[model samples]
Target: MPTNGGQIKTYAAPEGVAVADAFLIYARSVDSEPWIPVSTYAVDVAEVNTTRNEFDKHPISVASFDMDGPVEVQVKYTLNKVQSAAIRPKSLGIQAVIDGDNTITFSLDRPRDVMLEINHDKWQALHILTNGIDHNALPSDSQETWYFGPGINNGSPYGLVTDGNLFVPSNTMVYLAGGAFVTFKLNFIKVCNSGVRGHGFIYNGPNGGAILIERSENIVVENVTSLGATGFSLTTGEAKGVTISGYRSFSSHGNGDGVDLFCSSDILVENCFLRNSDDTIAIYGHRWDYYGDSSNIVIRNCTLLPDIAHPIHMGTHGNPAKPETISGIHISNIDILDHYENQMWYQGCISLSAGDENLIEDVHIQDVRVERISKGQLVNMRVMKNEMWTTAPGHGIRNVTLKNISLDATNSQIVNPSQILGFDYTRKVENIVFENLNIGGQYIHDGMGKPRWYMVADLVPMFINEHVTNVKFILTK
Candidate 1:
């Protein structure tokens, strides 16, 4: 384990592989963390572009490498104690082929969502024993894919196969042609291990999902666990270094959006936990082969629950132009719990609409704790109707900062903007701040559906708007 600046590798496996016992894989990050794990390294991968080695001196996203390029950087998997037969009966075995230029890095801390779905050979995998069990009577077994640990010999487990199972005959057999559904070029990660021991149920279903890092990336999914799905999607494109943290992107689908900062960037998602149905933590500006933006972000000590949508959503979808580029973003200590349906269609807990004006300056939502908002807006700086595409998230919601927030609404009401709903709305919303915040609620009226914004101290539509500019609010207690 070289020191000076970078180099730490340790893996032990021989204590248990389940009933058949024996496993160990060490280097648990070097004990007390959040820091203290970095050494020097930079053997010259393409002249060391973007400070590749030596762990960038500090916030280099953890997993670093770049010395004269590829050489089987590393790939590992050791399931200490799991296998319990009943793995069906494709053949009861293991095989290998051997090839290089492979780089696999995985790190999940746990909370839910833990999958490794892989089945190859034109979508082949059926050792189905149904339960009673007997993939060939155990004892060590063998099958269509099985490359035992330590050094791994012979075949090496038929290309690759995870958790297992994929047999299609009528379900559109691999799109009805020669068909095939197993070919990973490498770089894949889905870790949600919130402190381990199945904190929530990372993967608890008959059909589970985890290795869905969309396209792929030079990956690192930190302290992970998803407890749900539809969120926790990393997506891949040119594929750059990635780092996500203390995961818990809980979902029920139907727009379940959480921890989805699409396209991909020099990324990093800090301490997380989002329970969503739509927008618990969103950052988009691109689509398809995965574009980019949602920019260099850092979301801190979090806990945003949207059960439906909008706990923190900032998208600049301007049809998909490089996916609306950005500069930077940092949202600190959060604790929002918003409810959705912000009128017409989408809702908000913290929003900034679509793109074009570009330049969504360094954003921040400090020490936040927004609560109880039902089917409507809370902080939506809108101008939307689909302008050019999106990522504009600007129209005046500039140099933003909503610190020490705590908006309430036991059940509903925080409404007030009506009258001039939509018209060209060129947009320019402006330098905003809502310090030591504390609003009671009731002010909605976009067009008479007004239930409340709980207004008592002046509410001229939450302070009118002519594209609104240089705004301020500092209510407390």
Candidate 2:
């Protein structure tokens, strides 16, 4: 119901949509406000999953921005119905069909308050469809993305006897009936030595998507560490007064997003470490299954190590494709040690290419360092570049700044043109200043064909047709 309409739209998820304890919503800044700041930008916003009841568990982590030093915030999940089960993420379907609708909703209380963030990998995941979900009306175009599916082999023999209780090893090979294991497969991460091998933390095959909270508020996630074999976790939904900090998350073999915010607002994440296979952090504008954008988010002083993909990112194509952009998110003072190890699987360090149809504005990435990176190392702005191929009605990436960046890499350049044509086509980068920024070594970015070397020195500051200015870096050789 964004009556002050420009190009964004919001909708509610249907009734009876099943969801767990965690959910996420990601958004990007739109409009040309190079100096206006995210909190002050004028734009459209929305939330997701407005049908089910939400349970705000005390977040395992909590931290505060706006003030110096480490300040603690009490975390809680806004709850509706109490089912003795622990909180978990909801499963989603692949976008292989034209109307492949798969989503959940969370009804909420008016008093819940939560904070927000984004997960770009989830946005990327939301874009392409899986084979099981693939029912496309048109034949494959050469430019179409490859489609996978909700890969799961639930009935396969994947258990073992441990301490008298049945245990599930991560990579237990299972036999599928018709076809092959590839079709009904559940892949596992090959953790070196100290992988997640505990109770309630087994590789639960596949069919996993997300956990959610709806219209939740006044929650805190503090001092929690639940990494490896974990999927989407520690969420606040459509609530105010939220905080997530001093926590650590591990990665699993499949899609694992840490600390998501959906249809929520006024959230903060600080002093945390995220190690997962997908997007470490994320926020959104709104979804058909849910409604709301991440607002007033401050993620600072954290360590992000996505076991598979980007350590930090935001905005999903579904949001912008609906002509709705994620908004008002800030990420700062973080260290990301990327292990881009999943090549045949994952991608990117930080990707901004959610969709070009909506507004992607007021994103501030400052004082960040990538301690280590591989070939397919850093960001992609593909979503904001192309119009015909993607969704979103009218959009641009403005007032986004990447300042005070220092990284230790092999061949990673600070920024580039090939992977991130979005900053090239839509807006002029202003105050996108980078000072005292360092880049080490060089390599090729894996998925989107972007380079991972200190290439920003080459592509940025292009006094050109469009990307005349940018998240520029002023450094010493």
Candidate 3:
């Protein structure tokens, strides 16, 4: 956890958490020193009520280390009182050892950020973040680095509003030093070639979004912790060539999406942590004044916890006047920790609801493992008309694939079946494939018999409507 390129530092818990004395976490890359653990609060499962209290009284350990490639992570905790332990995504295959003195030691090789839990739950766990290459390295001859140290500084080149939001300008490097907690929103409007990076915290005050990248290009946001945005943690509208890595965000308010890409292209969001009340990551077309198709987006190696809505939501908004197409979106290696949505129509661990004359195609969701789904379905794909945002139904959806998705919904109350439906023949969904989809220790295949299709009711296990064509389930084991 090196900050400002200086000595490596370990962060203490923010506040109000009883640190466990029986646990110790450490990590190290090939060239860096061993990293110690930092204490942070994890949302208690019991406190996940209708009130949406994000940060509860429960405490967990978190540690971050930088590495160019792979790294080794170790956790030593008391095991006499614990029953079972496991790491999330389930694909990592880490093992544990029982040491003497009632302590348990586990080691795992992490290519990215991951979670470790005892008793196989999110109540008490460890979040280890592996930060990749530094994107904040600017040439010394470039523009002077605007440093916001620990306080309320108002002398920035970009004007600070009365509400403490910073209006970042173009062609500048803004760095918030370690331990610096700035209570402001970073606004990037119509700017290019800029970045916001640090180990500090950016707290977006009431009634404002945390980071807004609109109509900009070649922007990067890295290694920053943003807290409590009323709108979204990080949002991009009509922007392109944006790279966000190792960014951690937490939001508890309504409509507080993690990373919302609206009518943007060539965006990459990776190695991040997002716990939001709304969709963790949403890609939409044409919202407000931004009107166009969204393409070439990749969201990978991230841990998502949706306290309210879908972990991944797409194609909800589009322009009816011109009909936009959202294509070439790939999401891989994601660990969906929790998804809680009350409305059945808008509930899914992953949802692709194409509306408003939008064509959502060439989307691939692969290698995802859902550890727990409290109240939603596994997958939901539809081409329908939205009563709230669309004047017309979606055009068509084609060439979408879901591969190696395993959901352990053993403790979930999944009343509705996973769906792939179309509004009509003219606006149908076509060429959708499901491979190795495992739910509750059972694989979904043709041998399970033809799927039952339902209209306007709670569905069965796998529901494929009439207008969905060329739907194939290729299962292995």
RMSD of each: 20.2, 23.4, 5.0
Q: In angstroms, give how far residue 394 of model 3 lies from its true place.
A: 2.1
The CA-based lDDT of model 2 is what?
0.39
Reference-based lDDT, each prediction: 0.39, 0.39, 0.72
Worst 10 residues of 2 by lDDT: 37-46
Candidate 2 lDDT, tens digit per residue, 355-473? 43555677777777665555454544443433443444225555666656654644343332224444444443233444454455332121223367635445332222345345445
User: What value does the lDDT take at residue 258 in candidate 2?
Assistant: 72
TM-score of candidate 2 versus the correct structure, residues matched by position: 0.48
Give stretches of model 1 more than 4 Å off. 1-158, 161-233, 236-260, 263-270, 273-282, 289-313, 320-353, 356-401, 405-425, 430-433, 437-470
lDDT of 1: 0.39
Assess the local accuracy of residue 371 in candidate 3 as a C-alpha lDDT between 0 and 100.
Answer: 79
